[model samples]
Target: MDLDVAQVRAFVRTAEELHFGRAAATLGISQQALSKRIARLESLLRTPLFLRDGRGVSLTGAGQRFLRPARRTLEAADAAVASVTREERPLRVDVWGHLYAPTRTLAQVAGRAGTWVLGHGRDLPSVTDALLDGGVDVAFGRVHPPLRAGLTHRLVRLEPVDAVLGADHPLASEPSLRPDQLSSGVLWAPGPLDRLDFLHRFADRFGVRARTASVNLGLAHFLAGIAEDPRRFALLPADVPLPEVPGLRSVPLVDPTPLYAWSLLWRTGDGHPGLDRLTMACAAEARRSRWLEYDPARDWLPEPPPGSTAQVYPGSTPGGTRADAPAP
Candidate 1:
């Protein structure tokens, strides 16, 4: 039987997410519409693909068996279309903040690949949308899990998260600090749900009472919030410039330190020659970068707090590394 590509796409996304709400949200469709599509797909096959209970849905046996073939079918279709329409275009990459490491690495790689440049997505959701819509070829950013169904990502850099504060702050003089030590200051955390979850998870691991102040403002305001008050601090990736402004300084966090993963992601089956070139550059670059030697025993932090309101990541295993690409 011929399967509708749209129905298969919905099925794959739903199976990967196992939550209609999240899957529907990612697909930009209503939950009821997604459910009807799933039901129709099941009707055509004469087999139930998922089993729904109070907790949520799980794939049925037939669904489990169909998963691989469905993925292959979608991939083949994407590749066929790309091959037919293959043309050279400047690859657009998404950049986050003043993270120079990724920028430098991308330049080093993409410079050899004719033309490519950094572009900005309005926000993380927009970045995901850009990737799905083929507006960008690759991205260097945080890879929040239950990732969009058709993309694959791997950690390119692992940097210890640090606290940024005014240099005159009492804690700023310390070379390194523990979570308990940071509890003294009010933490200025991002108001975005994903970022908030990460911050809370970080706080929970060390069992620290972080008096966090939510900031919906952009980075400038967020940093300014910390600078205005000596008792305020913000978490930042290590690569952010020290003394971001003249008065601010970044201090390392230790004694239950949690490393923030900076990842490189792209469409799963994208056969862009520029992407292939960049992948090679990435492999070469990873060999020289310090982040490649992550010791899970030393780097891994404790799980999220007992009563974490955040949704736990569905799959424990990250996507498989491609044979030609660098292992992240």
Candidate 2:
């Protein structure tokens, strides 16, 4: 064949993402060069490979016909080349401090995927570097890494992060808790980097008048205080079903803004098949579970500091860490 192996490899990637921009990024080539390679391949193969449109890109029949064999050939090439490079690279799943629950959930679901969730300690600059360098397959927390670089961004789920408090607390009965209601009280929160500053934007919206004091507060301490005193509170995803510690309740914020959102991420290059497959599986399962809060009236958990790492509630498994995990 007149076509080069790189061209064939580009064809395979382009077919999968169905976009030249993504295909080039994944292949780590200029889009113009990638296009020329495809064009050259079309000329050599004597067939139109793609149907480009203003909306996006798609494949022609000839391109579709070549897809499978091209993929197999390229994969085989990688396998052979990988023999020299094939070391058991640890799967470092990136997670910042704010994403404790999601990280835990991913660990549970990735039981069969040879997964290890690495806590990145909320440093996005270094974390983003690790991601692009293939040091970690995924990162699950708030990040504003520059776009237009090699990346594929996908919003996994926008959870309504909120604070859970005891029902006996004065603000618990209100339609939505105000910041001022929390200002006079202790807060359970994460470190400075993990704190959701956007939540403060609503302080003005709801006339709550609140601000974070101990920015380094951990989740474990936050929950401990809430568990010990009815007056203490902690900000959390409204969907989290905090386990019963002794006396606690979940309060939704009148604020519609999400405390923060988590995303599924990978390098701009062609993500490992296994990584994409596993991540998509976890995200789909997470969406399916909905992770709803059971009831605030149960009264089992206490508020602790944002630095809290202790499992306030056990989940629905035989050995769940959550004391409130559903009976097996």
Clashing residue pair totals per candidate (backbone < 3 A): 0, 40
Compose the digit string of candidate 1's lDDT tens values, residues 207-310: 45645565555566667777677887878777665434668877887765666655667877866667666555555555555554444434543332233342
Candidate 2: Cα lDDT at 5: 86
Error of 1 at 36 (Å): 35
Please report the TM-score between candidate 2 and the true structure: 0.49
User: Which candidate should be chosen as best, given TM-score against the real structure?
Assistant: 1
lDDT tens per residue, model 2, 1-328: 6558899988888887998899999888999999999999999999999999898898899887787567656655765666688743345577664434666556556765554557545555666665654446666664443443655544443456566776666677766654455666655444442334434433433444333334345454556565555555666766555654555666665423333445555666543545655555554454466432222232112121133342322221223111211210
Write down the worst ten-residue block by lDDT for model 1: 310-319
> How big is the positional error of residue 316 in model 1, measured in Å on the Cα after superposition?
20
- Which predicted model would earn the best lDDT? 1
| Runs of candidate 2 exceeding 4 Å displacement | 1-90, 111-121, 144-148, 166-168, 173-189, 192-195, 202-205, 215-217, 225-232, 239-246, 254-259, 290-328
